[model samples]
Target: MYSKVAITGMGIISSIGKTVEENFTSLTEGKKGISTIENLETIHKDVIKVGEIKLTNTELAQLLGLSSDNNYSRTALLGAYAAKQAVQSAGINAINEYRTGLISSTSVGGMDMTERYFYDYFKNEAVQKYITAHDAGDSSHKIAEYLGLEGFVSTVSTACSSAANAIMMGARMIQAGKLDRVVVGGTDALAKFTINGFKTLMILSDTYNTPFDNHRKGLNLGEAAAFLVLESDAVVKEQNKKVLAYVSGFGNANDAYHQTASSENGDGAFLAMEKALQLAKLDISDIDYINAHGTATPNNDLSEGRALIRIFGEKVPEFSSTKAFTGHTLAAAAAIEAVYSVLALQNNVVFPNLNFQTPMEEFDLMPQTTLKHKEIRHVLSNSFGFGGNCSTVIFSKN
Candidate 1:
């Protein structure tokens, strides 16, 4: 009943890899990028492990060819790099050739600099230029300008689910015939503010994260940027583009239960998945694999596990959370997982949920612990954020 939106290009720069090919190789090799923090200066660096990308801010700026005096924050630098990859991967020589837009998401836009120079801004003039890049929309604008896109650029900041909502919005805009092609995803650089904020909640894991395990501690914060180029059928047909996957279903719902935790029953998550299925016109059985938003936090896994049982009853399909491999990327979690879902559909394999040793006693749910080969048709990806914001996106092989 709805027009299918095709995903033609994807680009990602995470702790595991700098490009799509490199990320795929890391996933296939069962490599985990979680480690001690190397970039951000934080007091908890000794105890907290994170999925920090190895590139420094200067190196990232160099990669984007920005001058030393450029006001681009670390967020903008990483976003521009990944977005440029997405545009290039999509094979769009002229960005404005067709009606194209960019929808990016970020939680801590430029806080890395803001927190660093909070007091020094009064005296230091050289670093004061970064003050303008502190807003959430500035990173999106920087990414758009770098990609040569001048149309319909916006940003979403629903915390962790921001990128998933961005992808959903891009798909809807395409379905509504508002744009021929659009780039949608999220970016966030590790910042002291976020690390300290999460620490205040007592969810920062000192060791490796173990999703769905009884002894699971918590999440390791990470920083990365990922983007997917979604185009309509007309654009794909006209250009004969290579369709990587189809954005068949997407939904968003808010539980409104708590500011940071999901409802005890995962009501918002269930509604989000139900809406996605309805849009896809597919049943629960059609989902071959699920890239869960298993942040490895006690509340998220328990709530999301309950939602799984509620949705599939006794026949839940194979599901795993790739968070352990890339740590919890906050806003970019869903975007990178969406890339992993497309990869699963293309390769017919499910990535193993690393660091799982014990199953939760609350349910019989067991994550995929090994890379298993199978014929995957539809892959479901869930992303639940703070303030009970829950989102689901389904990718189907074309």
Candidate 2:
């Protein structure tokens, strides 16, 4: 039998909340955060809604107490804030005291700032500092430096599933005895780059996104970050850590079906889920809840729903998509949902998928639309990204 990776603590900043407890409260209270865009400068402001965080860049920097000259991007600021919370929650006085590492993911990277200074790069020396921050790994380095971490630090950019892949790697590393503990998650900020990109694809919804609904339009782009501390069994024993949950199983697969759309059959999603269940030594009936990758985009919801019915046949578990509460957060979607999954397990409550109305005509499946209270032991979460990257991780009550 394989050893289980313990999740000691978690942190998050989203349209829903800025901390784990706050996010939990919002989830249980059925509070929705998707609304009009406020922080971004885009022509779609009047056309689309997003789960944008209310804090400004300067405000976030102030929260982290960064110097005015610091080149911390919005992604880095959000990451450091959430990572600090995770480390503090884990009670790690000395970060390098243990064999620790940080694995962060971000598709937005510094694009938020890059887009703002795109035309002023040569004309303005003031914004040149942000030019170097315009990649996927820069924020990881900044977050590491901010946290005083000097060990293995890396960033994963698997599109929307980036954070879930980061968590999967952290768990595999702990199980392989490569490290004693690790902080893993992702961060992102909304920008015209992604806004225009998805807009060109014509998937931006005009109002609230409704996952699995028959008349679903598309997804609303959002921004946020989240991180979780995963410790090995030996470290958990040594530190007497109070585990919030266990990382029992994870699986990732690529369907290579489309550049930006999931296959009609959800081939990658199916293999990912199947492999996760097998790794967890779990059967179809064992999963108590499913945090689906239901982006509400017509292609995604239909593809994911088909995958669910294919996997469990007629017995798909209580499933819901929290994206309605926090618009599709690109790279950070899985990380925040991971926090949501843990919250569901901790409180024994399944969050309602807001905005869902009529059941889809493609299948007979329906998501849990009301707050459901049940004995949730194992929660399976799925995150699929562009380029057919699909991932799933199963979290169990400790």
Candidate 3:
């Protein structure tokens, strides 16, 4: 068995709210953050709604104490903001006190700046600085620099499942004694690239996203950053840190069945969930809630619904998707959902899966459409992404 990986602290900036407490309040009160695009200028502004963070690049840059001469992308700025919050919440005076690392993930590292300066980079020397920040790993490097973390920095980009894998990797590293503590999560800012990408897929919901509903249309794209501080049990005891929850189980599997589509039978989802249960040494009956990866996309809902049925059979726990409140946050989805899962465990309350109305015709599974009060002991959260990547993480109340 691997050493326990405890989530000591977490921070998030999403459409729903700017801080972790703000987000938790919005989530429990059934507040929706989906609205017309505000920060970015895109052609699809009127046609689509997104979970925008409501902070401009200039505002975020100011918060990060970056000068106008800096070239930090919106993704990097938002990531630094959340990461700093997590570090502060953990009450760590010296980040390098123990062997530490940072594993961040991003699908659109700096596309927001790239799209803005695509043509200006050649004509404007000031804009050329952002050119280097246009890769998958640049934002991660910036986050590590912000936190002064010097060892074992890496980035994962498995689309929406990226952050979950980052958390999983951090846990494994601690288990292998590679690092005593690690900051892991994902970040993505709104961009025309993703807006049009999902638009092309015909899965952009014009209104609110309703997951697993018969009348569901599609998903809303959102931008946010979330991070978790994972430390080994030994380090936790040595530092006397406050343990928020334990990452007792995690699993990752690939369908390899399609590039972006899930199997009809949800084979990849089933494998991922089963693997997580196995790692946690818990049974299906142990899960008190499931934070589903229900993006409300027709294909995803059907496929994820099938997977839930296969895993839980007739006694699925009360579950919901916070996506309705925060929109699909791409690389940040799993990380933010991890925060929500931990919140559920701490409060023993299951937040409603907003916009869920009717059950699907194919499966009998029904999500918790309204805030349900229950003693949530173990929560299973699923996050499936393109490239057939499916991941599941189980958080236990300690």
**TM-score against truth, every candidate:** 0.99, 0.99, 0.99
Put down candidate 1 lDDT per residue, 142-230, tens digits, no spaces: 99988989899999999999999999999999988899899999999999989999999999899999998999999999999999999
Cα error, candidate 3, residue 346 (Å):
0.6
Q: What lDDT tens digits, residue by residue, belong to model 3 across residues 76-164?
A: 99999999998888987899999999999999899998998889887988788888789989999999998888888999999999999
**Model 2, span 259-376: residue lDDT tens:** 9999999899999999999999999999999999999999999999999998999999999999999999999999999999998999899999898889999899999999999999
lDDT of 1: 0.93
Runs off by more than 4 Å, candidate 2:
none
Q: RMSDs, each prediction?
A: 0.8, 0.9, 0.9
Q: What is the lDDT of residue 345 in candidate 2?
A: 91
* lDDT on C-alpha atoms for all candidate structures: 0.93, 0.93, 0.92
Clash counts for the predictions, in order: 0, 0, 0
